[model samples]
Target chain A: MPDSEGHPDFDELELGAVLTALADPIRRQVVAVLAGEPDGTERPCSSFGLPLTKSTLTYHFRLLRESGLVRQVNRGNSRMAQLRRADLEARFPGLLALVVAETQQAGKGAPSVAGNTARAPH
Target chain B: MPDSEGHPDFDELELGAVLTALADPIRRQVVAVLAGEPDGTERPCSSFGLPLTKSTLTYHFRLLRESGLVRQVNRGNSRMAQLRRADLEARFPGLLALVVAETQQAGKGAPSVAGNTARAPH
Candidate 1:
């Protein structure tokens, strides 16, 4: 079981960190998927279907987790991921919604997120 | 007069770019300052008073400008900067407002944005 203690609390989340985590186009896609999931449904990490190595996906997930945007936990042998929507909304209202909307827009062949990187901000 | 062609147009702005530009604490502080200024008020870049070198400040301003969050133009030899609030708001509604609000919450002695660099996300 992944410890909930590892996650930053709502009040503990920094706006910069949260923004940085969502800065990547791939991470924004992850958030869009999780945000649309039913409440309390923790989807397995592999379910995101991003075209990246497991290691890269893990790194992105860790960024989201540390930034308090998402929570991951062990469910039997699988690690599940879910958005901390309620907590994030409480802390910074409408932030996630805008990102999700943007992600959807990007998917629909809108302007690309050029010059953005998937790597953590150094 | 800085050429408007140098800046990305509304349709050209990317969500990831904007988020990445706001990812840095110093840049967010810069945005907070510009967001509060009156309509059409172009503040000189040096007037921001950030404890950073001129090169570093120029880099931050470049990131904000390229990300379409700000516009800088030459005003009688002094480079003036202003938030691209109207453009950003049209692209991503409520995004700037939330960032400004979160910045205010930060000002109230909230949790600090540690680990976020003043440098660009490389």
Candidate 2:
């Protein structure tokens, strides 16, 4: 798979960068949505429906992409993002699943997609 | 349990803070040491033998305590730290184990105890 410029390659993925990227509630929420997709779906950034402004959304997406958590591509007129699930699992088994499961658990009352910050899993 | 001032309470733990605390290689190593300890044993921070300055070590411990990943208590002349395993598991099931496992996996050859940055799972 071709990676965009500025994104870390598979071998370059480091624990610190990945954890830092996932450490943000917004980014974790984004990963939750993408990782939960059944068919490796790539969704437009707008589909996340985060309350963050466009710039903030861009920043979070960039962090995720740079850390190798998400892959972004320019599709038609919109930029779409998808979780690098296989790569992450290969490098760090149980890590992403824990993150997604914890996020989902913490955001149960008000899912992070609804704009509320995830509570427990952070 | 009585948390010292500035430490996040059990109910106050947030996923972002925990992930950010773990994002640092040194801190992850510290957590690794403590989490691997038998019977929830608390150890003096110096026992980890990290190569950082004392101030830097103190800083990492504080970050861990603040994020609810570790708890510290004064024992005689030394302050001891231990992983808040039960609390973390209660708040974020499977999260801490994933972090410790991933950190261990990433630091397989060198072992973070020796001061090398973890290679993968970042």
Candidate 3:
């Protein structure tokens, strides 16, 4: 229900900052949660199953909102978060999907190889 | 033709470390160059047009090689660098091409909008 930040200006955020914000797997997981849900579906920060404390969860959401990676709005006792996919792709083509796809790739429902460097081209 | 680092091994790198290494735009450009070249082509580090001191350039390539993002082999006066695409994808699917594609997407032949954030979602 509270507006983003002391001043929520979506136009001024930078892509690098957003990418850096999402670089953390926890934050990426949060974004994936929003990405998986429909645009107006409000999911509380607690829904992501991240083990961080509430303050940390708030910080993560703040970073995502400031990075323009998500749009957050207060809705009664809980806040609703939505992925700003259109806004992101418009500014940086193919970035949002690539990152989203990366999260899914990283979470391959199976066990992972110990280490992987670039193996597939194209 | 100098071998990578004081030693060379491909199996010991970490994905997060590799991602952190490629997070820099300049380093990403270097990866782009190697990605565009044929597997065996030997383009010297000087070929990338980055305006950094030799030591810094050496550092970047070293990071790339050690991260398993590229394989460097002694080939006469210059070292040949090739993307270890197969190795990367096997370990982390959809990362290399996504990054390479991101580089190409970033270097738009056309001018970029002053700013763009997610505006599209699939």
Off by over 4 Å in 3: A1-15, A99-122, B1-18, B32-41, B49-51, B66-68, B83-122
lDDT of every predicted structure (CA atoms): 0.78, 0.76, 0.64
Off by over 4 Å in 2: A1-11, A101-122, B1-9, B106-122
Ranking by DockQ: 1, 2, 3
Which residue pairs overlap in candidate 1's backbone? none
lDDT (10s digit) by residue, model 1, range B1-122:
43663588889998888888888878888888788778677888789777778998888888888899899888778788888888988878878787778667656764444336635754
Candidate 3 residue-wise lDDT, A37-74, digit = tens? 67656677887776568998998888887778778778
DockQ of each: 0.63, 0.41, 0.10
Off by over 4 Å in 1: A109-122, B109-115, B118-122
Pairs in clash, predicted candidate 2:
A14-B122, A15-B121, A15-B122, A18-B122, A121-B15, A122-B15, A122-B16
Candidate 2 clashes: the total is 7
Between prediction 1 and prediction 3, the one with superior TM-score is 1
Top of the candidates by lDDT = 1
Top TM-score: which candidate number? 1
Q: Rate residue B102 of model 1 by lDDT.
A: 69
lDDT of 1 by residue, A16-120 (tens): 788888988888888887776666557666676677899998889889899898888765666777789899888788888887786676567733332222222
